[model samples]
Target: MSTLSGKTALITGSVQGIGLAVAKVLAGAGARIAVHGLADAQQAEAAVSAVRSAGAPDARFFDADVRDVAKIEAMMAEVAEWGGADILVNNAGIQKTASLADADAATWDAILAVNLSAAFHTMRLGLPAMAERGFGRVINIASVHGLVGSINKAPYVASKFGLVGMSKVAALEYASAGTRETGGVTVNCIAPGWTETAIIEAQVQARAEQFGGDTEKGIADLLAEKQPSRRTSAPEEIGELALWLCHRHAHNVTGATIPVDGGWTAQ
Candidate 1:
């Protein structure tokens, strides 16, 4: 039987990038998928179609702004009515770079709302039902910055670190009862390093503008200093790890902040 043959997985920010990749991977593993993102009806449908095409037994899209708690709650309620999710992947996030001396309160609020608080909201709304059902998987897509520091990304770092702590607490709360021999619900986090995503591309562009319009030099310096592997991670690779965290074989693994970064945190 497929690992997730009878499970339903809900993934946020799933319209593109890491979220989209994770959705497709889970769908291919036989999980009925709920793709959530901030998008119009047409765009949402397109994502649903893509998931279905990737081999999901069933698929749908939920549109909501993660920064809005009320909207997130409403969306989760709607999802619960449609048969609650068995796997919740908190993959939605936004990156706003700023030094502490120059950080704006509004930007900090927005970043925290999306990157950290959205996961909290989802877990609060999603966990009780999971505990009741005796099965659940909560995976947060964090970053290497959660484990180590970098320049000019205070909000992002703080949010991811908070998320790691939250995941550990949730795991302790929801771990299956029974001498730790059997597996039930689990919460874990993945801290990815630099990935070749739109976000990274935007950062590269910004660096190029700052460095006399030399994009290659900007990317090279970024890679040389950051990822020891000198290569950006693939979203699909992260997707595979996310799938593993949801599998029955990984039942014993919980509360860990696993890094998929290319040796970024090691330094």
Candidate 2:
């Protein structure tokens, strides 16, 4: 495990689910934490408290509606007051399950704004400082859907694919800068499979109900159909990978989209 002592990490949409899990993992490794999430002051504070309990040297929360560029910019500026984040995790996302014909334009635009465009806005603002400092980590949390398409997920797939493409471009631009003076900032994305988060739990429950309330069968059927491993990933597993990517040893790894999808994409 790499120690992130003295470093600051900023993760967006971290009040719950995978985002919160990542925050806790990074905090446990000794990083100061800046948690950004939607506008819920109580939830935001609880997130900060979790980070603190996880042993982060320092922790704070910033609430903003990431779809609003102005609000995101304001929040970033506030975080900058504490000398900017050394690691940036673009983990904020929204999902809509609808076919192309069934999906409305408003939902598509909303998904894109939150899932794809917000990452772009944050990266544009956050990467400069990392480049100047010469050491940074930018991890975008994409999904298996980014690599392969799925039914009823047109908008989500589109946004994630765009995110992956954007990550590669940023990686190429910054690939040569991580030297002794420059802190070897690496840009990468993680495409997670069906994971055991609140989101997935809700999905499973819905599927279970659809199958006459057989929860285990619903889980088994879903995993058997898609993932060869026949299991869901733990949020901490994704966080651990994110932590590894932020380590100094991973400095040489950039512009890559590593899948933690339990062989979902392997097929």
Candidate 3:
């Protein structure tokens, strides 16, 4: 069965964008959702409701700021008591655009804290139990920047690159934790390039207005220089790949940094 029937999925930054999209797909596969994010009461509730409606046996939101290690530890303890994160998706991330010389200390700290260090904490807390159980899936939401780079995004690039490196270490460490019968412990990254998320909506809107409100034209124009496919991936597309990885068939697909970047990395 392609079902995570008795599993619990803890997805960070799941209130919106790729995180939320991933949550819904896992829920649809019958996994219970342990939602985490920095969202208001209304938005958090909406995320839980969305997952539940998508087919989760249950869906509950865990409030925690990923940038804070103490908060993340507290949330992990709570999740352990509830059950345990059978599948952990480190999707919470923050980005700021700045030149290498211009990037401030605080900005660098915040970006690394949320994007890289936070995943370290969660994996440390969650992977042991998974190893004991002989099954787990750790999906880190990295970026195309993890594999390459561009201008005016020093900290963001550094954080993503760090994430990619860290995930490889995790993958190798737990590569032999399970067998064919069990799904096995796997750690992987989804390196998405210019997906249609709120993160890029402002840019899209600005370009769309410039092109007489033709959003398609705006998207095409924005992706022209980079993404060879010239179309941004839908958030749901990323979610679908995450779901595929969670399936038992993908047990051997550990340590992979799969790109849904419309061929950006291919170049």
What are the per-residue Cα lDDT tens digits for candidate 1 across 72-150?
Answer: 9999998898899999999999887879999999989998999999999999999999888777899999999889988
* lDDT of each residue in 1-267, candidate 2, tens digit only: 338998899999888889989999999999999998875677878999999999898998888899999998998888889879899999999886878899999999999999999999989999888888889999999999889999989999999999999999999888877684445988999999988776577668878997899999889888988999987888889999999998887888999999998899998
Give the Å shift of residue 63 in candidate 2: 0.5
The better-scoring model by TM-score among 1 and 2 is: 2
For model 1, the stretches where C-alpha displacement exceeds 4 angstroms are 177-182, 210-214
Clashes of 3: 0
Whole-model Cα lDDT of every candidate shown, in order: 0.88, 0.89, 0.93
TM-score of candidate 2 versus the correct structure, residues matched by position: 0.96
Predicted model with the maximum lDDT: 3
- Which portions of model 3 show Cα errors greater than 4 Å? 205-217
Residue 146 in model 3: lDDT = 98
**Which tens-of-lDDT digit does each residue in 123-215 have in candidate 3?**
999999999999999999999999999887888899999999999999999999988799899999999999988877777887899899998
Error of 1 at 252 (Å): 1.3
Between prediction 1 and prediction 2, which has the larger lDDT? 2
